[model samples]
Target: MQFDEVVYRIRIAAGGGLLKKKTKSEERVILKGISGMVLPGEMLAMLGPSGSGKTTLLTALGGRLGGHLAGSITYNGKPFSNAMKRNTGFVTQDDVLYPHLTVTETLVYTALLRLPRTLSKGEKAEHAEAVIAQLGLSRCRNSIIGGPFLRGVSGGERKRVSIGQEMLINPSLLFLDEPTSGLDSTTAQKIVSTLWELANGGRTVVMTIHQPSSRLFYMFHKVLLLSEGNPLYFGKGAAVLDYFSSVGFAPSVAMNPADFLLDLANGVATAESNEDQAAIKQSLVNAYKTQLSAAVKSELDVDSSLHTPTNDRKLKRWSNTWLDQFSVLFRRGIKERKHESFSTIKIVQVLVVAILTGLLWWQSPVDHLQDQVGLFFFYSGFWGFYPLFQAIFTFPQERMMLSKERASGMYRLSSYFMALTLGDLPMELVLPTVFYAITYWMAGLKHTAGAFFSGLFVLLYSVLCSQGLGLAIGAAVMDQKSATTLGSVIMLTFLLASGYYVQHVPAFIAWIKYISISQYTFKLLLSSQYESDQIYRCGTNQTCFVRDFPSIKTVGIGGRGSIVAVLAMAVMLVLYRLIAYVALMRVGVTRN
Candidate 1:
């Protein structure tokens, strides 16, 4: 891989969205005409201080960057393109695995989604096992890759799993971002050494490192050192110390060369004034321009037409078919969510809430129109809010994982989105049933089979709609706390406009009732239960109970309303999921 005259300009917003309308914008150059090359068998390490643009440069090289960037990058002397992107692998700084999946299961699922379509199930399984063994994770192959609430693999093992994900593709070029940031010194060295070995096997590797020990620094064949977005040195790793010595910044006895170089780049090498540090930085820049740039360019300069095509046929858009991707994601999703979906604590919480609600509205009288309306709306508010609050965490928690996998072209985002909807449907469908079974009879709701089962269907479908909305919120925000807050606000808006709390909203916002799932659910349940003619006295004030709610017809709670309510839920499901898919596609390899 080779890049020349690479430049990137980032527009910095003055003060986020809260800024005044007429605020002037500013532009900061993150990368400034950076140029370099990596041969087939070379390990290049990018070292620089924070904000020095190491990660930015890595993203450009991987062909995954967004926004304004200008550069000419070539692979095997041909200009880089999507085909080259497919032929490369990038492991992000953070490990993005499903915490609920075991090490082996994680790899197997990724392999199924990413491996060539020609590979059979057995072949994919074999490939996953090989990666497990190669990463030295055989002992913990079946252990979970846990999160904050779970305990499973060690940090080093998790890092290996992250690397193994990219290794599964056997790409010609690999890029990693801070692969050793949180690892122990020994583990850090092992990772770099493994990259060196991969380079020896004729696959080019590029990575950014924060601080490396002397031993680890030597593993890289070439080192690119940047200072304030400019290359201070871009040449052989071993010759870095020699170059610094020639520039009169030699390291003291027993001092690590990497540390010395960092001090020089950070403008703290000498104990003199700030003016002296500026002078030193300028001198280093001039030295590279005068002595090294020409040599580096000569080594990488190649004729554009000298390369031959590697493949003669067209490449498949995806390794797995859409259905295959869906089925795999479907099964993997179930496995990842089984514990949380069916856990004893979650079930207990549902039961407890159901029992409490049943007691609150227990033995509701059929003659009291107000109680019936209250009961229906209570069910609506409870089911709608509960499922939405829980589902809000779904996409936000997995946003990073999805972003990384999708960026790698593992599977179509549409397939994953559809699978996600299907996978949660079963669990989502079951949980509402459990709640209804516990609360419906206990609350003395309409006991007839048609009334009971129809209400149950409406309840389940309404909950599904709420879950879809939650997913959209999570995807749109891509942050758990923010999604939670937004979901609460949305559910509250739906609740207030549900036509049960206020009975009549003001003319200005009455239109919100049409969009609230709770309103439809409440109307559907009311129509299902009250279509019967049986009636009793209402507090000795009347013999019939129809006078209490005169707005039923006006609110559209009739036979047609029942059907429209169900259809509305279905429409919301599709609409919210479509919104989620688009939001997910726009999300990148990392949260903003």
Candidate 2:
């Protein structure tokens, strides 16, 4: 309910890269024993200029700072636990929302995963609606969150929604980073006022503000003035002017408190005596330290007697509920997937490619033998690319949403990994089916119902394999641009390595062919075509024509190997999914 004592001390300095080559001359101490406290129903504003360790202090308070520090933070009368970390909510600078989802859908999905399972669907929806109303987002609740290509919610409403999501967990403490960085003065004041109301409702709110307007500045119950990570003041906002006046400067009524504090910390106008400034700084530091130490010690003593045992029992109980955890995660994943475009462009693309292939290899009375080889190569080669492309584009988009949800503890990594794999099936089936139906008949392959179904199955399987590859790559590299580039390179390498065009590359490169999803898919398609051609000949001309196509003979490894290849590709997909999940989990855990 309250942060009894929060101490954030940071040691930052330039260090060497791998091999210990010196990168900079000396180390710098950014924050030096900065400490503050927030009681229940209190709003604290971290006010400082740029690069003053405002955000860094918040990170340290939240146990997100991956830095060396010498301080302790206590929630109430005990050291903060991992449960506190899980319960605490952090609203980041960017409002990371899925552009396709409406505000209501977004909140509903978050509630389903984060709200206790004891709540019914109607209860969850009711809770979500209440939060939306509280955040002043009801007007835009049903509107879509937009991206560069689409029009949706406005920036201010989006920001509120971001905060609303954090509030959904009903956390006792909330940390926000620059909540009004780019907003207009009026909008910024509104946001700050909303935060004030939240704090008044008993949620301890702490946030960093760079240069808030006068109205916005006056809203804070307490202000933490920091300069290069050193605390100047950490008390009542009204006391700031009096403190500055004591140091020999009278602040004008119109002068912003934020500016007045920055000037004092950075030493503006006439520079004060070094000894005097140092003494003033030391006095404030000691005051905070004493207060924090007492609070922390008191909290620790109480926690030792009252909460530690129960905390362990709670953790043990939660650990046993894996099924419950997975169900919540699966539901969230389904919601996220439903919002994606699934690329209508891709569907159209598959149809176009199918029609082109059909036209290029249209059936004829006098079949040129070389045409069979070419058709076999084309079908195998292009179909192999399907899975690769699908994975590359789709997975990157999903990864962004996944990262946000994963951080919020929507579900476990494995649940999302499975749900995404299954969720993609419907879209995956649609495009590949369209491609196969058009290309199969157009290429003039023997069209017995058996052949048609067999080719469709092979194509669909290949596409899934490629989707797996893309998802793996996307998960491994969190950045969309980097993932796309890496995926493209890998797909290209696989395409060339598969024995489609360069049939007899060296034995050393032969290993690539075995692992390549395209290799098996191409081979299977060729075998299917050969088998279908032979069947059609038996039915139409009453003669076996399998020996007529030389390419079929060269595809000599037989259908058994091709089946094994498909299975192997599927296995590789599973492995990639596992690897992706592991990588993503590590990322989520480490991210601040």
Candidate 3:
């Protein structure tokens, strides 16, 4: 892999007012003319103090950085291509693993989705086991990869698991960002040793290191030292001391060469005066540039457009077919999310809400038409809010995992999404059906089996629609707190426009009732419970026609047939999910 004159910059809004239509923007340079190369069977480590552009250059070399970038980057004397993307593996700074899954389970799913289709189930399992043992994760294979609140694997163990995920595919080029960020010295040395072993296997390994012990530093075959985006040194790790010593910046006392290099590199980055920082950084950059022999400079320069037709022919889309992808993703989604969907707390919450609702409208009289109508609307409101909040959290929580797996070309977004919405159906529908079984009868809405089943269908349909809307919001926003806030505003608007709170909404704003899932749901539930021919008692013991009731006349504007209500809700259900799919497509994968 090689990168020449790689430069990257990002534009950000400098300042803005609450009502202003525009804001001042400025560009910040991240990487400036960074160039380097790593060959197969070599281990290269990027070393620098914080804010030294180490991570930025690492990302740029891996073909993952996205910004205003210039110059060229090539792998194996060829421009970056789809085939190289599939053959590469990238581990992010943070280990984004499912906390609920055990180490074994995590690797197993990755193998199943990513390994070649020619591999059978047993072969995939064997591959997963191999990665576990290679990474020394056998002892914790069955332990959960826990998170902030959950206790599971240790820090070193978790980092190994993250590396194991990339290793499972047997990638020819592997890139890791600070794999030992929080590990102890012993653990950090072990992680570096593992990378050394991988490099010796003929795979090109490159990584960014925050700081490393001397032992860990010696494990690298080559090192790239940077300070404020300026290269300070680029050569063998063993030779770094001599290079810096010859430049008159060697450590005064005997100390670790890695520490001495950081002290020298960080001097410019943390200098008090801006002029001094720039002067020192520029001199070091020029010194490093001048140090390169003319012969080596000529050898390093190459055409960025060089084509490797031999590797280009190996560009394959995915490892498995659509059906296989769906099955694997479906099972994985279910296994990972079942705890959140059907935990004891969630079940108890649903049961408690159902019981309270049943008590609120217990055995309402049939002639009490106003009370029965209130019950139907309340039921509609409950299902709408409950399912919306539940499904709204799906995509936000999985954004990191999705980005990671998709970048690796493990599975198509469509397969993963189809499996996601479909797999959760059975689990999502169960609690709502239970809520209705109790609340429907206790509220005295209807007596016949046909009435009960038809009402159940409408309830489930409303749930699906609300859930899809939630998914759309989550996917588009990609932030939990923001999505929840937006969802509340939208759900409240739908509830208020359901034709229950105000029988006659203003004509201009009343159009909301058409798109509101709650509106049609309330109307459908009203029809399910009562008929037009029914009669209710009036003030003086005289009877009034149910057709003349206020809610009936106002909410029944779309005609009395359940077909229109059902069909409208169905259209909304499909439309909302289509919106979600498009939003997800925009989030796709990161590439060159």
Candidate 4:
């Protein structure tokens, strides 16, 4: 609730070259004994020139310092705790959003995760709509939050949506870093004005702004001007002029206050006298000390020692545990099925591949069991790489949105993990069904009812295993380029380890087969199709066909390799989900 005498100190190694070792020293103090408060119904603006540590100070106050914090930060006279940090909402400079999701869907999805579970879906939707209207985003509520590839909301609107997302949780304190950094002048002013209005409505708003326009400067009730990590001014907006005047240097009437302060801070202008300079500096120091002390007192009065009333009385009735959270996420996944891109290119790819496979092994009778086994392996391996490649290209966009929502405490990492697992089902089912139908029939594999079901089961298993592997790889690498490179490498490795070219793998590399989803899927499919006693007779000499197929039969549970395939897929799903969870937690939802 308040920060008293907060200081953020940093030390770095000095310059070093190949011939000399680096020297360690306290190179600089990024935030030198800085102090500020964000009381209810107040808006505090942190202004400073570049490299003045404005963002660093804001992060210190917001409890997002990670390993960079120094000194004490107290809330209501008690040291800041994790619970206190959770009560605040922070919006970073980047507009992290899902390009495919419309503004309304984005907000509603966030609400489902962050809002108390007791609220009905109708209540949640109503709450989200109200926030949308409040932020003046109603005109584009249904529009997509676009990137270079997709088109929808403008930069200003997207910034407002990010703010709306934070408000959905009704946080008592809101922190924003350069909220309008990249927007045009008109849009920037409008955004700051909206923030001013929100502060007036009983929310504590603290934001770090760089080079705000003249009009925007007047919206701040209080300002913290920093220079080289030291506080130069911290007090009322109008008082800044008087403080400057007291030092015998008057600012031009037309000069912007922020620009004037920054010029003085950078030592570009000289004070009339040495005493004038000292007097002005002393005045700022005293003002900061007094204001910081006052903030501490205020925070002490409403300390957590005294029982505070609950703000969300309505939230008491909604009680969704982890299971309910999973279910809600699962439903959202189903709804997102339409977002899957099944373009003409994808359909054409399937058709082209089908024709090629069919023509290569044209109407091969069941007697050619070796050929059938080869066809099964080829189809399974090809389908295996499909999901992996698709995920590498598409998952990054979803992850961008996921990170934003996760930062706002919309849902637990596990809930999102479950949703993604469930959401991919429809596409997985459709692609494999199409690929297998065309390939299996075209290759002229035995089409007995049992054989048809076995082929379909194998295809589904390949799809699931591929998706799981893709999800794992996506989670592990956050960047698109890195993920794509890693995905290609893993797919290639799997292809090699799947026994396509090398029938006998080295002893040390033998374990790779267990780890490779393609290996299991192809192996099971090959065994099921090539078994000597199966209805689909390969050659008149069944012995030769059976001997040619790998001896690693699907021996686990029942004679059905399909069952083993299912078991392997189940294991892959859990492994991938676990990898996703750990990666999400370590890297977090924030892109930077």
Candidate No. with top lDDT: 3
Off by over 4 Å in 1: 16-22, 270-275, 303-308, 539-542, 545-557, 586-592
The CA lDDT at 129 in model 2 is 93
User: Which residue pairs in model 4 clash with each other?
Assistant: 113-410, 118-318, 367-538, 367-539, 369-538, 403-589
What candidate 2 gets wrong by more than 4 Å, as runs, is 1-30, 265-267, 270-312, 315-341, 364-366, 393-403, 532-554, 557-559, 588-592
Candidate order by decreasing lDDT:
3, 1, 4, 2
Model 1: per-residue Cα lDDT over 425-486, one tens digit each = 88877877988888889889877999899889888878888988988898888889888889
Instruction: Tell me the tens digit of each residue's lDDT in model 3 across 1-592.
Output: 8777778898987685788667679888878777777777899999888998988887777776777989878786777667787678899999999988999999999999988899998999999999999999999999999998889899999999999999998988999999889889999989889999999999999999977888888889988888888777777899888877676566666776778778777663322335475566666777788885342356467555433444566656778899999999999899888988999999999999899999989998877788888878888998999999998999988988888888777888889999999999999999999999999888877789988997898899999999999999999888899999999999999999988889879999999988999999998887776677777886677898777889887777335456788899889899999999889887654222
Worst 10 residues of 1 by lDDT: 545-554
Candidate 4 lDDT, tens digit per residue, 322-389? 77678777876666545554667787887788778888888887666557667876876788788877
Q: What is the lDDT of residue 199 in candidate 1?
A: 90
TM-score each candidate: 0.94, 0.84, 0.94, 0.82
Model 3 spans with C-alpha error above 4 angstroms: 19-23, 268-277, 293-296, 299-309, 557-561, 588-592
lDDT of 2 by residue, 1-592 (tens): 3332334444456678788876655555666666566776888899877887888877777656665655667665555565665567888877888787789988887777777666786898888999998988988988988877889988889899889888887888899999998898888888999999988988889898888877887888888888666666667887777755654555554577777677666645223435466555555455446543455345334433422222633542132145656665555555555555256676577777778778887873224546766665666567656665556665556655665665555666666666667766775677668777876676676758977787788777777777777777777776778887887777777767766567567877778877777677767776665653453243454654664444444344345777687678779868877777677666654242
Which ranking of candidates, highest TM-score first? 3, 1, 2, 4
User: What's model 4's lDDT at 198?
Assistant: 83
